[model samples]
Target chain A: MAAEPPYLELLESVDSFPHIDISKTPYIEDESSSFYQLLLPNDARCHGYIHPSVVHKLAWTASFQVSHSIPRTVQLLDDSDGKDTAAACSRAFYEVIEKAVDSKIYPFLKTMQWENYRIVGAKYPTVQLLRSAARLFGICSRGAHMTAYVRTNDGIKIWVGRRAAHLFTYPGKLDTTVAGGVRAEESPFECIVHEAAEEASIPADFVRANAKACGAITYVAKSSTAYGDDSSLMTPVILYNYDIELPEHIVPRPQDDEVEDFYLWDLEQVKQAMVNRAFKTNCAAVMMDFFIRHGIITDENEKDYLEILTRLHRKLPVPTSPSEA
Target chain B: MAAEPPYLELLESVDSFPHIDISKTPYIEDESSSFYQLLLPNDARCHGYIHPSVVHKLAWTASFQVSHSIPRTVQLLDDSDGKDTAAACSRAFYEVIEKAVDSKIYPFLKTMQWENYRIVGAKYPTVQLLRSAARLFGICSRGAHMTAYVRTNDGIKIWVGRRAAHLFTYPGKLDTTVAGGVRAEESPFECIVHEAAEEASIPADFVRANAKACGAITYVAKSSTAYGDDSSLMTPVILYNYDIELPEHIVPRPQDDEVEDFYLWDLEQVKQAMVNRAFKTNCAAVMMDFFIRHGIITDENEKDYLEILTRLHRKLPVPTSPSEA
Candidate 1:
């Protein structure tokens, strides 16, 4: 065996989130508890977990049924049509929580962005939740991360960004070229197009034409600072990774305050930065995956080649697909 | 929700092998029992499971110590050195079994080729076991599979092979263009190079330069037919997948009896073949992963996109890397 590779630790850092077995975990519905379930109207398929420190403040209205035995199972009591009606009712519930929740008590509320994220794997119908609340409520969040590079005379040079220091999470860390959470009803590709334009100042048409969806990386993540809370979250996320080859002439400028600057670094420099823990945890994982796909890191050189490949795409203990009828 | 995709069933079929609980399972060290453990000398990191139906026939030689309560834990009694000595002893033990055991009772012995596969994750050192005996002892077997494709005016077309009907496993089923089990001390790329020549008649230099190591696919596979036994075997495999774009002038001809014929089919035709269950279970999984990475399978078109990606790279419950210390 050779020396343990530095990049494997990067994967371990991002995936330190513990696995929760829903069958054994305590759930509270009617009473105030730490974990609550978000149930649907007609379907028994979808399941979500939210912290009681947040949801306990909400008044139990008539439109909700709290199941005592089912550990935080809260069913929407909408009498209208099943799918969309339940979605609308769930949306209203989150909106009220977003406005009424005290930021001092639930610090995650202070970081709320008005954007909406649709919970994945919700069959028959789905609900859109506030982006900031997605982590508080343990749901499989979806996002798109694109690696933009230019073919240089030396080799392929990647475009990387230094996140703004004032950001709420992972501040001052290195990040992928373009990455953002998937907005409501948006496809992964469309999300990349939107993020590419907004974050990297790249044109949407160029991204739509050149950005190729390589695959996705799924991991359960937890951090105290990421969600602005003392309670570490079960933040399971699915990031659809992409790669785009840019013409050498096109340079990326920081379009918004989210990014401070952009740099074109060669492979060795990028790998060193990863070893230095300069990149954000998930973004480092994305780059490590990209190198494997492009044949930079291989089974010959890396001792943990197979382990890293498998760990980068860990299966969610929670349901990640629509139920088959 | 939309109708369930047929390809998801293909993934599920290959991964139906049940998870074994090592702690709860009974072990036989002194007496006849079902499960046995192969313990390495001075190293507690690596562990292997073998069915007693096969190992019980071996003579209780003085060169081995079988722990009574440790569930058939057998330690090689070699004092010369730690790693290589243990490997030599293990090899000698299996050689004796190969010569003395009745083929009628242990049918897998008849299919034993002269090839040796090094057992992965053995810490202090490692051992090379007979390829045929790999699944009998549930170790992580490594292999390489390469998908060859051509870029035509019509679009990208993939080259697939149909296995020969007389083959022992997956006879007459579809397969990747080039694939073979990794021999001892052989890297995955070297395995692909060797397999490409022996299986597809491709030149070694061309394969060396053109093949790109995209990623890998892993699964715990079990089937009565694959291993020629009544008791289904726990066959965990890691296949380092590669892709190569061949010029249209180059054609893949069956260089050996392993393959019957090769065909160049477009994307839709390949997908239809997968939906129809034409490919071997693991080979179909490899192709599905290829499609996902090439952007042919999008999140919009495939609802199980994230689920499939994560499932294709399942983390083995068994240790997969060399010990950190």
Candidate 2:
């Protein structure tokens, strides 16, 4: 009989990434007694919760009332008149946040150039726009990330890269070949092509033709950006996944300084790196998801295969759309 | 802009399948005080729990020991030296059950043909095998199901079918295009191919070429098969999901009597059927999974989007694989 394929042999490893305890993480809820009542960016670890009253100071915080049914207690009302209030509050909220950053209250906000875009979610409607740095805090920002790999005679090798050391959050940690947040009005497919060109110097045409949709991963976990005595800020993220098969000769070059360097790493090396915490906290999720999907992690090797699979695909709290609301 | 897809328009309906409260279902556990102590197939609903001491009548019971960590209180031992004993016990157990079935212990089972298959799990090494009828009693079995759809110019439509009325379980209920349990030696993909041909009369070659691995759904809910004074069995299932796009020209004829008839139904019709209990309990899960994955079920339309998704993919009790055991 022919020998087992290289991918099948890789599944024999009994090692797995440390289980992530999502329950231990904080949540954004309506209850006033809940811990980590607000979200903060990774760089602004010292900033306390951006109290709803802060937005009230701008005279437009009426719609940010708490709701029991929704995970995020602070909701954006959907009534046409209430929508006007929400829109005004959003505009004022954006201005207040931008001014605070300019005043250096969130000192880490100075680290990168402002992308001049706003994030939105199904949980709430927003006309407010904030810089890229603070979008993930107290908001749902959908991002599209792609892992580019190549099929080789010996085995399948991933084109891995490292986050630049100077970056504030998870500096120098590993990342997928092409990863980026989806900006307003940008489709996931469109974002993948843009990130592919910007992050890995890959041609848009090649990525568009080769990428395969690999579903998505969702997580609500605590970040290190918590204020004192509070465990940390909790953030919710929905990452749409894709697999792009690169041609053997098309070596990836870093188009931006966001990534330090790229390397062609084997599946075992990637698996070991995941176990070693070399990858960014969330990037580790992406790698494990890919491995399990490709059947590199089986019931034979992973003690909690079912648990891991369930958590990997756990649905995050989605906002109700305006029309439906 | 192009006209809105028919599938998208179908999402306007807020109706959904009746909520399945799996947590409220009985469980089969080793603890003497456990609510549901055993599993009896659908047809044997009137027969309640089967006492293990009854197996001693055949003098083949040894390792049905109680354990703390294993799912079924009745554990299967994995000691290598005891292989012969376990094998003999397995053989005797098979014969005893067969004789009982042939003796009409389960009259409903007599309606179906017996495929020579025994269920095995990673949690314990098996020396003996039981007929397919009794596999769910105290052990875990994994099944693979496929939802095949065709792309229409008006939007995506699905090929749905009804289970034959003469079947013992869920007779005349609606079902996906094709679904089946994994045989002892067959892999999920191999089982899918076999089932596709057997149930839908789709060619083996078409299934092989078009199937896409969409992931799996896990559930461990109590079966409604209860006797006059006692509740029947509780079973756990991990169904691997697949989506195969069928070419418009090929019509599926029911090869096996398992499926009664096929229909080229629109999304709205399927959604209405789900809300009306037209599909079997588990098949409802398969359709909901398809809807959520394909983005037909949104947070706006489904008040409990997260709750529904969680229930659809609830984690099952996965036994430790034999090697690990």
Candidate 3:
């Protein structure tokens, strides 16, 4: 049998690959493209499809910043797709990565590496093929993705990063570190494991729990700062809640090329920071609520973050439409 | 375009033709034929890939005894396949029927005729094709050949029948009515609907809700008083809860050819009956519990049934056999 062409190899050879800028990557119009439109909850819209490289950039630039940015992006994504699709995408992403890692295309890589190298990096043919397959499956055919939540003694932390500045959407803003689109062949459990390792530098063995599935959300972006198009659509996403305990001393070092900085925040500080708008991204606001709800973080400061999250939670209505405004 | 081979003609012929006595039909399990085993939620085994006629027989018989016997069979079928698959099958079946009816295969059909005829008499090409497709797709599949469930005014009801004197497996004893080996291209929903119409003459529309998948269970049924062959195995069923409200004056009339008699009981009565040894099929006992937990039924009589269901639920161990135990 002839050896299959190495699609991943071809992708890795590129220099200055197109990356999604976490800050610049505008929320994707729900209808911009099926890719962006499909990964959200029903009440949310497509915030954007950040290039894999951008995720790595944010993780490396400032790990702590990711705490805020990633959650915000997720919220944006959820808002664009609607609540149902967002949750579905979340669950689906987690599951796909967990499965991809199990297949072992990239081993022992940190979450950031996994994102750019394995998922966004387009190093594996399976990932790319799965993306195409997902598109063909139509909205109803899409499977749930995966999401992981990790906490260490360094402080209550979530995996996040910034999109490469050069990318089309949200360039330089923080975003999910260990998150990625789910492949057709994998389950939520499989996707998250791969994403966690690839994006956050978390090892597969470090994962301790697979919690209940949080709901889904959707988001849709209008013609704006990025993508410069009128196309608007919804993206569906499923979210899963996972609990992981890390050594208090363990400092998550974002892959420098993919991330700009990393930070470890005390649960209270992070929560207070979110309330105080100390963080630049909505990702932080969203994740703070996730942590508090899951009981991963409990402090008076958390109350503020919790309140913001609750408001956002309520703000993102089910079956929402543009006309609702 | 040679007239589409009379697709509608074929369907009508099949429906109008005199019913076949599948009970007496000589059927030889095709050992050479490939089969798929799906794992369900209870300690019951469901054999998939049997002939469609057999499936009809099981469903029809079960539906006739909707009040008592059908529930048992549904329980056994549910136990055979995971809840997700079961639910998927139910949804798929309804969709196919809806589509077929929309296409107007049989015109001038009254609402009741539409529901009843479509439920029992509808032929599903997609479900028939699923067995092979599932394998190609790497999905674990199973067959719940002899089972059926109904939605009653009060809540979901499963039906089982006391097998006739001249039958195979569990002859002259209580068994599922609308269930049997699920054939290729037939989803659980279609299978049950078909069975219900044939056995109970119930309109499909009256079955407002479809099966609620709880999960699968596997058990071994050694040849006993029901069967002369010691080597033969029996795969009972587990089923989901569905609701179908009927006029207060309407009474379920079982087909004399298929069932000895039929009666309606509240959830508690059914549960109590099972616990007090008022019923013969273990499958029925288990289904009652599934109904209770899903909030399909509540009250003291149902509570007693739930207790028996709980006890039975605990007694059945995982099947020991590797293939179709």
Candidate 4:
């Protein structure tokens, strides 16, 4: 057999974070605790993992209305009359932390684009957090990705995107044809349809009619911005994957700065790019899963076929869907 | 929202077995050992698990050529000049054990149909074991299943089969359109193609042209025949799933007694059957996975969408593919 393909390495890179028992981590306002578990007001489940650096600041923020009702648990106290008090309190803390922390030390805090990411877990209602602070709090965020392809005389050709170099994270990396974070209060399908039009210039009507909700790709990876000294965060992501077959006449062009250009590459070209590690880590996984489902990657050709399939769909410790309030 | 649909119960049924620390199980022909780990000749991997009742008999069968090279492990000794000595020795011991033990006490032994199941594990060459004895020794078995559906005027319709009532196992339970054990040396695709012709009477030429190989479903369940006495066993299975869109002109008829009849059911009818527990345990999982991939089961409708998706594709402890040898 040829040397093990680079695909497994890409998967491991995303799943590279060490397994830490959040249950054993400090919950109360214990300064000695290296990590803090995010908890809801009354829910018993751990909502997220917060590093000590952010936890210290969160404990000092009086307006945030945080609580420690249970021993060794950090629950966000929301007694206000607002409908989405959890979101209000969380946004308040993130804003305070952004001003208090050094941008050079915590670069992610400086890239607040106002995109809201909804975090949900267990019995706790959904809370909207700033997208840039999702990784800092070790929250499980949702995204929608779509792979558009066309059947041509040559064979199946996939639409690939190159991220703009000016982007904040994974800049200049290859990405799926259309991908974006599922903003607060947006369903995965609606998010994908919106992203297709904004990122790929595909008409929303065309996407709605053609995009097939294939399933999802999930993984828990250490945030790329982890400074590895005093601060680190776990970033669990669930990307609802979609596949849309476009006609030869419908060409995809970049409509935003998120993507530099689009290329229709054949299977061999896609595999080469994957092996070369040009695609973003999770995007490679989404494409790899697509290949398996489409039969391009089979048990015969890929030795790690089963491993790849299982790894791509790791069960996140946090809840994936929003709680109906 | 809707009483947490019965789908999760079906998944829990197949994955209902408790996890045991197989590493702690005794080996090296220890009479006091409750369970014995099966080791290969000169291979370090734990190939299978043996209940004490079967292990006691295996240790006494000298001609079967078993050894205890390592502490707390039963290694099958294969030093003969003949090819595939492991299979030959295993067959010899199983035959003796069958006659020594009463058939009424172990009913699985009485129904051997001479079907060979190829068991593969880490670093070990594949060994063929009798299909009836696979569960007796806690071996990982391979099977192939295909769901045949057609686009109808009303909606999409699937071809489902009812197992023959006279069958010894899971009799009268509903099953996928085509499913069968993948025998030694047969690829999953080859096995599915063969089963399509033999079980469903679908033309081989048509199946070959239309069937799409769409990954696999894996699970580890306690054998139903496990008397829950001293002779229980774990059964790990991997079923390669295929999707074939048959034209309305073509209809499937039962070609053998394995299936009594085939019915074309709509989406709601299939969901009702799934909820009613009319389908076989693992077959329900296959259909559930199908619905998710086809977009019938979605995050909006199903609260446990991510959990179900991850549970359907479990990572088996044993190797899924055969070693080159």
- Which candidate comes out best when scored by lDDT? 1
Candidate 1 chain A worst ten-residue window by lDDT: A22-31
**TM-score of candidate 3 chain B vs. the reference:** 0.39
Q: Using TM-score, rank the candidates from best to worst.
A: 1, 4, 2, 3
- Per-candidate DockQ values are 0.74, 0.16, 0.01, 0.46
Looking at model 1, residue B96 earns an lDDT score of 48
The superposed Cα distance between candidate 2 and the true structure at residue A28, in angstroms, equals 13
Q: Quote the lDDT for B35 in model 2.
A: 32
Rate residue B7 of model 2 by lDDT. 30
Using DockQ as the measure, the top candidate is 1
What shift in Å separates residue B183 of candidate 4 from its native position after superposition?
1.3
Residue A237's lDDT in candidate 2: 59
In the range A109-155, model 1's lDDT, one tens digit per residue, is: 66656787876776633567777767766777888999999988898
lDDT measured at residue A241 in model 4 versus the true structure, 0 to 100: 88
Question: What is the interface root-mean-square deviation of candidate 2?
Answer: 5.4
lDDT (C-alpha) at residue A95 in model 2: 54
Q: What's the i-RMS of each model?
A: 1.1, 5.4, 21.9, 2.3
Candidate 2 residue-wise lDDT at A102: 65
lDDT of each: 0.76, 0.57, 0.34, 0.74
lDDT of each residue in A12-46, candidate 3, tens digit only: 22111122222333443322221221223333333
Lowest summed lDDT window (length 10), candidate 2 chain A: A39-48
Give fnat (model 1): 0.87
Top-down DockQ ranking: 1, 4, 2, 3
User: How much is A113 displaced in model 1, in angstroms?
Assistant: 1.7
